[model samples]
Target chain A: MAVATQDSAVRTGRATRFVLYTVLLVFALFYLLPLFIMLVNSVKPLGEITGGSMIALPQTWTFEPWAKAWSEAQVGVEATGLRPYFWNSIRMVVPAVLISTILGALNGYVLTKWTFRGATVLFGLMLFSCFIPFQIVLIPMARVLGEIGLAGTTTGLVLVHVVYGIGFSTLYFRNYYAAFPTELVRAAQIDGAGFFQIFWRIMLPSSGPIIVVCVIWQFTNIWNDFLFGASFASGSAAPMTVALNNLVQSSTGVKEYNVHFAGAIMAALPTLLVYIVAGRYFVRGLMAGSVKG
Target chain B: MGFLDINNATKSYGSVQVLHEVDIEVEEGEFLVLVGPSGCGKSTLLNMIAGLEEISSGEIAIKGQVMNGVHPSKRNIAMVFQSYALYPNMTVGKNITFGLEMHGVEKSTRDAALGDVAKLLQIEQLLDRKPGQLSGGQRQRVAMGRALVRDPDVFLFDEPLSNLDAKLRVDMRTEIKKLHQKLGTTIVYVTHDQIEALTLSTRIAVMNGGYVQQLGTPKEIYDTPSNLFVASFMGSPSMNLIPVTVRVEGNAVYADTTTGDGSPAALAFAAPSEVLKSYDGKTITLGIRPEAITDPEGADRNSTHIQSVETMVEVTEPAGSDTFVTCTLGGQECIARMRADADVQPGQKMPFTINMEKAVPFDPETENRIA
Candidate 1:
């Protein structure tokens, strides 16, 4: 009956379609409202943003705020011409994502293919990591970092993110590899291809979409992470998120909302760009190795 | 000793044994089939032989060398799995030569071997295509090429054609037989299809309930199935088993039973075995193949004695090549494979000529052949 109703609605309901499109358009506009406001204000002269409506477009459309945000912003964890902190974020994210994804793929491979006695219990323990509040680990993680003498370094931050990222990355890959054909693995074994050879040559090549999903998930999480960055890696090694916070909250004589807007957009731009480039792949990869023909 | 010998091999998962002591000596260049219904441990036995499954006890030897703890690849064997199990990411050439690459054979030699196997399997045109790009038959050919290129002592095929459509399955079956003929390689194949077992194997191990029920050539297995299970399992439409009592009358021995209508009918045995004579007053299963019980004109002419029993035809099914006439005999429904043009209909009296020379008697209690 539901199908029949949908069939008839699909054939005849122009008014229904119009209402749906109108609602969707309204939501799309509603979500874009803040970004629209920020984009408009970021190019306006500082005097103009401070004077009146934040909604109105800039009269002069100067790129001074963007330039200041990119290279001359006074966040100052580094004097590397603007602390662009963009590079800082990338430094933290790239390794964290790569290491976590590779480790996750290996964990997934072992859990699914070379399962041992306590594998389920071990996987369950790792799954527990995904759910544990980040707050629960902060003090212990800080203590461990300090004990290991990696307290405020970029390597320390990467380690923290890698540890935090494994649970989710493993979950994605474990589920994907669980559906991958064991027969192929067996065939590879009979072909005299050892453990790592099969994984590299066969499993890894076919693991395209899941790898994309895993990388995207880890990239977004590690890049935008303010909590870990603030708690663990402060000082010059602070990631873009922590630096962006410093820039916005520093109160350096004048309240430069334009610089703040410009900085926030720059901080959020990499993840947004990633989404734009690989968002479709993220969805496709999530479903890869999941269904068998 | 044969080229490959499974000496009392058994397999178990924890406490539950899946395959019992299975012994079969596969001669070099021989084709051995393990055929049975699902959960009958045929595939498990095949896996045990392939070293994919550990033998609970006993041993498998190839070239008279014990392979008890040998790894599958180390055992010098290759298997074509039911799914064809082609590495989807690799091109056909890469898939076929993967084994050689793993064995550390240099590219020059590996490419030459790949070319030879590709030509042999007629998959030369498919060398550049991924497994996903090819049709099911093409994947099957590539899978076979992968196995063949290895030049292993044994080629194990685990229901390799079970994934194909019926027509393609038949074509591949023929191609496989032809390949075996050409290569003369020892192969141990597992399948649940009886026809495939009949057509492909030089020897067959009919297994059931964790035991090798009977091991024989196709003719021996089909014509003289050692037990009731073998009789019922090996043939399409299966062998008709009728409960009959033996009666000794001077120089002749007869199997006497009632029809579906409770009317008595007696079928005499031609050249009754001495063991069959011992069941004079006891009941036994009369095992007769469908082809052996047919219309008078369709009966085997070479047989010396053909007993005709008039019975009520319960149904007549024309299956293009043959008309299967189902009739009531010995208080059970028996099917006879007659010529397509045979005059037969439902609920009519028909004479189903039973070739008594081809019939075997099984002791009712043990289910083993008495004659």
Candidate 2:
């Protein structure tokens, strides 16, 4: 009787696991369905994309759309493709992410360790800046960029992204650094280290997980930002997101669905590749940043 | 000038003062432990000494130099933090040598210093491991090693062993005492554990409410605390304080109290001291250690001053070597330490001897020791 009961329990457990797996699989497919459709439609020629079912695999897969999307797709009056704008985005993002993350780390260190009498209030005000919508800053940012003689340039876009992205980067680093032990800093000071020496040798070395978190966060935000890119930049300085919009919305020629999808995929590939490469660190970073120790 | 002198050191955050004007002087090789309960500003005082926190007012001098605004590193002191504060990223070797490296010591000198510290701490094998990979005791040793490598003018420990388990704490306490003996370095240690203060300190400063309540040798602090707070705070099982009415009969002084069963009792002792002589017929707080009041058989029978009193035992707690027996004196709970093998039982009226020679009285109004 005991053996029979154990066998029945095993069967019930297997049934429950099966139901759980099936539900998870459905959710996974439901989330991935759009990407699947985009991939399937991206490889097909224009005629096949228009005529065939969207869910089906392409009847004859070709790289023409990808090639055209990279080099010859018309965006505005020119057909110079996404290559230049992709480079423009890269130039803007690298410096923006680097500068903002460095500034955030410094700000976080000061706010936590060398805090003066109103430091907490200052931090609270800085944190409040993270919630302000991008639309609210566009006009003021444009004027600032113009006054600085960086208007409609990649440098202007980089400056704008760094200015707006610093709030989030600072928030990430401050939370992580606040959890970091202050005793290490004191020990370093007692060891005859000056301010920058302690930061370089003690604080920055222990800041790996938070750095990964801030860099990835800033990269994704700046790379995918269309609002700031469109408002502050145009022509040769337009970013990938702005160029992709122009490509997809151009009305002079017949609609090219495959090229549009390919352009969208191209614009998203860097961020997706970033996630694929460092996705493990992303979760670990978030967890470490949240925990005090 | 003393080796390290803190003259009227004060600390405040905004308008609220946390540490009042405090003064302490240490000789060249004294292990001074600052002991107090939590929120007593012991840590704040230590930080002030380390130059981590600004002195709100007054002066701190080391080796006859005023250190009010000197940077911590320039103060020529090293601190071992309560958390052991080992650099998480650096290996033990790196952590120990970081100070030397920051001061621009050459590679060879730094290596020699590191080797000496590692050997001294018996942590040579663990030097290559990061702090995260070390056990609690190992981290503590590395913290000490880091401070030791510097050979600073003074060493500061801020409750360094409080994180260890009970057995490890005792072991580390012995190791620290040994380290101090071998190095003969002037040290200022802070802890809330009275046992640590008693065992390791050459002198102790008992702090309460931001004031240094008393400062003296451990034995002096233990045997002749200056005030009621020192008397109660410095001992385990704590000194039992009972309100007793003082009476004088010729040359003898007696404390009148009640037994556990509410029967009247009086304990006769040597004549009251001049300070307490005026308190005749007035109630005062009588302080006696637990061991001083014990079962008759467990007490020093050869002493001429031992006085016996009958009381009902309310509870018996056998703690290995000694059993702590609780009873009532003047309607207040008091504990007596007896030998573990003593024949005592709860709810029984037993004759317990009180070592009247060791008893001290405090003024009820001022809570200050009278005799």
Candidate 3:
């Protein structure tokens, strides 16, 4: 009787696991279906993309669309491709991410360790900035950029990204540093470390996971931003997102569906690469608050 | 002036005063332990001394130099935090040497100091490991090492061993005592554990309600607590306080009390002090340590001050070295520590000897010690 019960229990366990895997597989496909279609269409020729089934593989695989998207795609009046806009993005993103992350680290250190009266209120105000829609700030930002003599340049876009991105970067760093023991800072002070020294030697080194989080967040936000890029930047200084939009939306050409998909994939590649390389740290950063030092 | 002097130090946060005027003077190489319950402002006082918290009033001096408004790093005092705040990213070696490096000590000199501290802490083998990789005790050692490497004029410890387990806490307490002895540095330590204060301090300041109730040597604090609170708080199982009326008959003074079963008993004083004479015909609280009231075999038989009284035991707690017997006296639960070998049982009346010589009397009105 015990053997029979054990056999039935094993059978039930197997059935439950089978159902669980089946459900997981269905959800996996649901999320991956779009990416799979984009990848399939990205490799296919323009004729096949418009003529053949979207799910089927290309009859003759070609890198022409990717090459065209990189070099010869007409974004505006000229066929300057995504290469220049891509470089423009790189110039804006690298500095913006670094500057914003650094400022966030300093803000977090001050808010958590060197706090004074009304520090919480100040932090609350900064956190409120993160929730404000960028569309509302566009006119003021444009005037400010113009007044600051940074308009129509990559510098203007970089400044916008850094300013808008500081809120979130500060929030991430502040919460991370809040979980850190204040004793370490106090100990460092007693050990004769001044403000910047403690930050450079002690706090900054321990900020690995959070730095990755801030960098990835600011990089992705600034990289994929179109509204600010389109409104602020002119012809030559436009970011990749703006150029990609112009390329896809241009009415002068033959639509070029495959080229549009390839351009979309190109714009997404850097952020995807960031995630793939430092994805482990992303999870670690999220779990940092829950698992204290 | 002593090595470290805090005169009339008071701390306030806006309008709320957390610590009242507190005066403490520590001689060179003295280990002063500030002990109190939570919210007693012990930690607040320690932070003020560390210069981490601003002092609202009063002046702090180290080696006769005023330290008010001085930066903590400029104060030349090292502190071991309760959390053992070793930098999580740095190795134990780097954590120990960071202070020296920050002060711009030559790399060779920093290495020498690091080596000495690592050897002293017995963490030489573990220097390469990060704080996250260490055990609680190891982290504690590293924290002490960090403070010790600086060789500062004064050492401040803020409940440094509170995080360890019972056995480890005891072991670390002894190690801290030995460290103080070997280094002979003026140290100010804070803790809420009275036992730790008793075992480690050269002098202890018992705090309550932001006031230093008593500050004296451990023996003085334990044997003659200044008030009812100190007497009750400074001992394990606590000193039992029984309300009694002081009676004077001719040349002798005696306290009128009741046994466990509510039977009236008269406990005659032996060589009563002058303070007790004024309290004649007045009600007072008699404070007695648990060991002072014990089984017949455990009592000092030759002492004239020892008197026997029959009391009914309500319960018995057998701790390995001794048995704590609880009974009612003067309508209050009183515990007596007896030898483990003593044949005692619950719900039975036993003749327990009371050491009246060691007992103290507190005025019922003021709760201050009468004698």
In order, what is each prediction's RMSD in angstroms?
2.4, 2.7, 2.6
Candidate 1 steric clashes: 1
Off by over 4 Å in 1: A1-9, A77-84
Steric clash pairs (candidate 3)? none
Restricting to chain A, the TM-score for each candidate equals 0.94, 0.93, 0.93
Model 3, span A1-293: residue lDDT tens: 98988877656577898999999999999999988888888889889977879889899899898999999988867887899999999999999999999999999999999998999999999999999998999999999999999999999998898888889989998999898889889988888888998899889998999999888889999999999999999798999999998898898858888888889999999999999999999998888898644
Residue pairs that clash (backbone atoms under 3 angstroms), model 1: A71-A82
lDDT, residue A150, model 3? 92
For model 2, the stretches where C-alpha displacement exceeds 4 angstroms are: A1-27, A76-78
| Better candidate by lDDT, 2 or 3 | 3
* Residue pairs whose backbone atoms clash in candidate 2: none
lDDT of 2 by residue, B1-371 (tens): 78999899888888988889899999999999999999899999999899999899998899999999899989889999999988888898998999999889999999999999899999999988989999999999999999999999999999999999999999999999999999999999999999999999999999999999999999889877888999999999999999999898777888999988889999886546766767889999899899999887778766678888898999999999999999999999999999999998999988989988778888878888886
What does candidate 2 score in Cα RMSD to the true structure? 2.7
DockQ of 2: 0.85
Q: Sort by TM-score, best first: what order?
A: 1, 3, 2
When summed lDDT is taken over every stretch of 10 residues in candidate 3 chain A, the lowest stretch is A6-15
Query: Residue A9, candidate 1: how far off, in angstroms?
Result: 7.0
How would you encode candidate 1's per-residue C-alpha lDDT over A128-219 as one tens digit per residue? 99999999999999999999999988899999999999999999889999999899999999999899998999899989899999999999
Best by TM-score: 1
* Candidate 3 lDDT over residue span B187-257, tens digit each: 99999999999999999999999999999999999989999999999999999999988998877889999
Each model's DockQ? 0.85, 0.85, 0.82
lDDT value, residue A111 of candidate 1: 98
